[model samples]
Target chain A: MSAKQDNSPNRIDTKRLTLYALLVAAAMVFSYIESLVPLFFIAPGVKIGLANAVSLLLAAKGRYKGAFAVNISRILLSALLFGSAVSLVFSLSGGIVSLIVTVLLHKTKLFGIVGISIAGAVTHNLVQLAAAVLFFGGGVLYYAPVLVVSGIVCGLALGTLDFVIIKKIKTNL
Target chain B: MKWRDFYIIAAALLIAAVFLCLFPGSGGKTVTVKQNNETVYTGSLYTDKEVKLDGNTLVIKDGVCFMKSAECKNKVCVHTGKISKKGESIICLPNRIIAQIE
Candidate 1:
């Protein structure tokens, strides 16, 4: 077995990895901005999920792993920067559920950016609520009605934003 | 812009509607406080008072219950505002305290 493989293939992979890292950083910045917005007054763990824009963009480009990388990093980093262990659990659960939903919906090819974003947003809230129930107690599910409605509105807003951004900028990745 | 997109949105809205309907509705006059899977306090929402727990405080006033203060880093419960309707709750996840209308 050779100690070193060909460097050419690794070069392209490195570029992609670099791009993924940049995307992760950008997503983290968005997450920080989102944290600054006082949306917690509306509901706990509720936001427009702006960092998802990066994930949505990557997923739209059919880069599922890259999208996941950006999303998980954004969640973990934001959880460390602006949240607690409880919030980390919520965000992790929400991020994983939403990422899976977005990826699955994107694979269908029948829906557009807005559709996938909405799917991801809804699932994210649902999974977070499930997490709240598991850790905080069943009574926490009482907040479901308001959370569901807020999720739809926020998801639609984010989806429209994603749609416009995706339409304006063509991705070759 | 596509029909499929509308279909997806409609489906999401329908699911949300179902969730809204399925959630326990308003009209509950009693408020129950649970902490760490234990029923710590149960009382009427009409009563105006406060219940202080480990590093957290619940305040009831004018038939609404809210998190007055908490040692939790996020203070999300405090930001949840007041809950006056049935099926509404204020949860302090770090303290595992949930004040819900019953």
Candidate 2:
């Protein structure tokens, strides 16, 4: 089956649009829930990347455009609502880099959902660190070790979630 | 799912762990506090002291430093525990303060 069946600009398929809108809404809700969870005490800016799981699901289903759209819109909207301009920058950098890494890793098919999720998590932190260095200074890299550890652990948990969810939905999807 | 996938995850985790273990050793004994891109205080981690800045206080005791108090809402710095190694740091983003062992 083709990845995208609709090419006509004038024809707006309500069903596909509704599905994509639902996915975006789901991603936003996950992002909102994640913000509600107080994770700062654990590590500054560390998160479980719940919305990324949705993106992973889309990527696994070969809906790359949908995944990217959902992930990007989620980041922008969440940041605007729940964070500052600085946070918007941080999430944008991290989310974009993370999406790229997950997509590339998923394309390779050399790794499972767990591995792709791990890579995405780690890349998110690293890129956020880079953004920190760029915006803050080189001194921020000192947080790298902790971020790495947090990234791996959170990735493992979220990846397992993604695995189970993907497995359960595999037949229907 | 596959053996290779398991290996990939294991390897990634091993690398992260190895890095965590190795990084702390590279930190120096000097502790520096920075705010707004400026170094505010430089001291010895071995010397127990208290640093007060912009209503935030960092307490260093027994070679470990932690955010004793902060005005931030989350108090993440206060909850981030302590730092004693060279590379370890407690960052209070709300206050724009970073206490690092270097």
Candidate 3:
């Protein structure tokens, strides 16, 4: 009962809660926008991953809990709203794995936001590719080179966008 | 972007380049089709053939292999166009089909 007190150490502050909610909303909006665009014309699975920017921003701010919550909520809500069960599985796996890598890289403090974002993006694609191989077969690995290259390109663009956003919002946050 | 960011990008690009070299898509003459990781069809790429699977139709003609049609929600496999070189593949996740050049 003592742990459930309002002043308990585990309780999330109103400010943090509101911030996480806003982050999740932003992530969902980005996901919807991305789905509207047909980047698959260029490649079967290439996407700008604009939604990940919110997670990247939270992670950069050292709000790991907020980042994880935002990422999971965004994926689940997006899947429920506009995606299928198959896509849900793919996004869940990719989102979780990439978040873990991003957090670890951020902890290293050796790389900048761009580097962390690139790592996150690359791992996300690789994990999704692994899921595809599991469902399809070894032949899917043939598409690895393309995914890797696309991950780098998309990650770079996303990272730069995140950097600018973070800079502008740093004072406010 | 910092210098360290460039290094990460370089490493990633190097890995991709290595993969590209490893799976050289040249001098391939045969197309192999697999379902659920099992080989269902293997034939010469030049020999025109239409393979009908549970929910996918693979067509090989003029030294190229492509998914002529698929009953999946996303027509990604069908839109993958054609593969004529070695190490190239068209995968239909929903149908669990993989058509590759070897």
Candidate 4:
């Protein structure tokens, strides 16, 4: 088989749809759980972002579009469910940026799923902070350093979680 | 890096955390307060103080204070002792209050 043919995303099928829906549901649950966890001291907006694991896992399976869809659906539904309009901006930006990063770094053979997850988390924060700048009318960019540091920490935790998860599902993926 | 590298990094982070925890703490400097998506107050903190929010203007009497009178369900910030130290904060989520240092 040629490289191009081997690399293309599989055609839309029930299995793929079901898999994506499951991933989205799982991600949403994780997001909800993250909401309950106590906040760490250093930063306010920082979170574990465990929901990203599902997207990263889907991205790893080469269902990038499905993964992107899952991200969008999760953010939209979560915002609607939570009734937090301010959250919509950050969620959309973070999800889009993380999905983009996941797709871009999909080919890399770094620190397993953990490294990929770390990359996704870092990009997510970057995008969210960018959104904050536009929303707050500027000067909020000064918080980038703290946000970045928090992202790195949060990403590492999520990365570790993803690594364990991917290890268990290596055969299925 | 390999998984072992991650382990080493984790160990290093743990050691650093332990060292910082064991070291003596220093009293903090600047003070910042935010509430309802707005920074209600900003000033220098020399010592512990009482923070009160009256109408539009927030008043910090002791040294430096924050957006006072939190109404959050948890009241974690209000219970976080004082804003006398640097990097301290009083956060009330229900009222969207955050008092910290820069």
Candidate 5:
């Protein structure tokens, strides 16, 4: 199918809007599923960040606005549904930082999708750690070693999954 | 994965290894508990004591420290098990509690 034309710069096309909504919903579901998994024993507050795959895919497709909107909406909705105020702060900071890094790396075109995803994952954990330090003092830095390692491992898994899905779908939208 | 992707992974692993080297092992003899950025309790790791905070409980025993219980939702702190290292910590973010072996 030919890509839909955007007749006006001010208005988003209907298909794009629908895609963004679906992405947001998928991101939220991923967030919920991640929360249910108990991986905290490896490192306190460590998450696989499966929800990031959605935004990463959108960002990879050069839909920066859709990625950003879907990510923010997912964070806010998930926080409201299953998180507290503290989690909301962490999620917001991590989500925004990671998304920005992913978009920038994708724009560079020097690295593969896996590289962008890994960078985003590491940045997300680091930003959340900084936020924790800001709130609870420097003691939280002790968790840095484990968080970094976990981020890399988890990011690699998520990135590979995204890469295959992206290749198979091959949608221009 | 591309060559650049491998580079990114290597760089990240290097950073983590650096951090791991910086904080080597469990050599601390003292346990410190902080709530809301205030030091509430500090004691020898050799002493078995249960620290009761506003909403959390920390236990230090047999040269190790752990969260015996907590009032937070996730219980991540409690699940952290034990730590006897100098820079190891059990953090309960929801309750703003940090129990560290220092």
Candidate 6:
């Protein structure tokens, strides 16, 4: 067998690996910008979550492994730059939930990056609330109901943003 | 993923945003002590928005924004009970109302 044939295809291809690295760097830039941008006048915590758009693009492009790697790198980089350990908690909580949602939605014909954003937003809120309860206690959960409602709204908004950007990219390709 | 899908998603998001913008925080009674469509007093400034004044200072229990102890008069803002619902209000000594979830 040829030497190249002996190795597993799962091993990173240098060319594709480089491309994935570039995508990850771009995702980090977007994540940083997301932190800087103002979400709205209401809850200070909510945001458009634009960074996850990069992940959606990867998943849609059929680079599932590359997409997962991009996700891990982005989360680590974001937490490091932000200088907060607590954020790691929120990120982990949000990330796993989002991945699950994306995979499930991936099977649907109507679903797209828009669905991915909605999943990310909703999962982010759920994880954040769970963290709140664990650390701050139950009383603070009075804010729980409102947060859930807001989550759904924020999720759909971010989802729509993703949907538009993806559509624009697809047409030109 | 298609041209038509874009329009469908956009419309859905527009509706969701509109709904969220209009959602009230908690559902409580309105004090409604306005003069010319302007609200005057609305319970304590910070506590109503939050139970603790800041960073774990004061806590409201049994349904009210209470001062653990302070020199601020109009503790009458004290009368405003803990409100978690939208459109709820507590009138202060200045005839102001603390509106939440509006």
The residue-by-residue lDDT of candidate 1 on B14-39, one tens digit each, is 87678666555343277899999898
Model 6 residue A126 lDDT score: 59
How would the docking of model 1 be graded? Answer: incorrect
Per-candidate RMSD, Å: 10.1, 10.1, 9.6, 10.4, 10.1, 9.2
- What lDDT would each prediction earn against the true structure? 0.79, 0.78, 0.84, 0.65, 0.84, 0.56
Per-residue lDDT of A1-173 in model 1, one digit per residue for the tens? 13566575323365687888888898888877876886977766678888888888888788887788778888888888888999898889988888898899889898878777777888888898899667644545556767767777777788788778778887654
Record all residue pairs in model 2 with backbone atoms less than 3 Å apart, i.e. clashing.
B27-B86, B27-B87, B28-B86, B28-B102
Across residues B1-102, which tens digit of lDDT does each residue of candidate 6 receive?
A: 344444444644564456455532243222223333465323322123333332122333333343343234655545454444445544443433333433
lDDT of 1: 0.79
Candidate 4 ranges with C-alpha deviation above 4 Å: A1-9, A108-111, A171-173, B1-102
Taking the tens digit of each residue's C-alpha lDDT, what string does model 4 give over A9-59?
555555767777787888889988988885756556778888887777777
Give per-residue CA lDDT, model 2, range B1-102, as digits (tens): 545666656666676677565444233277899998799988656556788889699987766889898997999999989878778999989889988887
List pairs with backbone clashes in candidate 3.
none
Lowest summed lDDT window (length 10), candidate 5 chain A: A1-10
Please give, for every candidate in the order listed, the TM-score of chain B alone compared with the true chain B: 0.71, 0.70, 0.72, 0.48, 0.70, 0.28
Interface C-alpha RMSD after superposing true interface residues, each candidate, one decimal: 4.7, 5.2, 4.8, 8.9, 4.7, 7.5
* Top candidate, metric DockQ: 5
lDDT of 5 by residue, A1-173 (tens): 23766566435767878878888888888877887897977766778889899999888888888788899998999889888999899999999998999998889898999988998999899899899878755445556777888899888888998999988997854
Against the hidden true structure, what lDDT does model 5 obtain?
0.84
Give candidate 3 misplaced runs (Cα > 4 Å).
A1-3, A6-11, A171-173, B25-102
Off by over 4 Å in 5: A1-11, B23-102
Looking at model 2 chain B, which ten-residue stretch has the lowest summed lDDT? B19-28
